[model samples]
Target: MPETVLIVEDEFFIAMDLQLMLEGYGWRVMGPVGTVKDALLLLETELPSVALLDVNLGRELVTPVAEYLKAHDVPFAVATAYDRPEQYGGEVLAGVPNAGKPTDERRLMAALMQLTGR
Candidate 1:
């Protein structure tokens, strides 16, 4: 079975772009969910092999989702415009792999591979 990836991003275009890219690479994509509530709801149903999270989701932060994923042992990477997402996400994101915004394909794929060990 193809590995599944959960994507937590608020921006519509960026989420669509990421969905297309990951699908093109032959992996199953779970969500490009925009909120912590949605992400957690999805997680309750199924766990992805890895996840990609955007640090900020409008008025809310992605920290709670990150914490949930961490506790579940689900590996994930952050996609952010910030040079240091940890500043916003706190210690939960200290050493987590980051796939910077504008979403470079190479870096994104590398982070995925690192997370999945594939």
Candidate 2:
């Protein structure tokens, strides 16, 4: 089966772009959920093989979602404009791979591949 990736990002265009890119790479994309609440809702039903999270989701932080993923042993990386996501997300996000803003396809894919053991 193809690997699944859940995407948690707020920006509409960026989220869609990621969906397209991941699909192109033959991975099943779960979501580009815009809020922590929505992301959590999705997680309750199904767990993706890996996840890509945006550190800041509008006024909310992605920390809660990250915490859930970590607790479940689901691997994930952050995509953020911030140079240091840990500054915004606190210690839970420290040392996690960051794909950065504007989404470097190569780096993001590398991190995802590593996380999923693909």
| Candidate maximizing TM-score | 1
Off by over 4 Å in 2: none
Q: Root-mean-square deviation of each candidate, in angstroms? A: 0.7, 0.9
- Distance from true position, residue 2, model 2, in Å? 0.8
Record all residue pairs in model 1 with backbone atoms less than 3 Å apart, i.e. clashing: none
- TM-score of model 2 vs. true structure: 0.95
TM-scores for all predictions: 0.97, 0.95
Q: Give the deviation of candidate 2 from the true structure as CA RMSD.
A: 0.9
Candidate 1: Cα lDDT at 75? 94
Candidate 1 lDDT by residue in tens digits, 1-118: 9999999999999999999999999989988899999999999999999999999999999999999999999999999988888899888988898999988789999999999888
- The lDDT per prediction is 0.93, 0.91
Model 1 TM-score relative to the real fold: 0.97
Would you list the clashing residue pairs of candidate 2?
none
What lDDT, from 0 to 1, does candidate 2 have?
A: 0.91
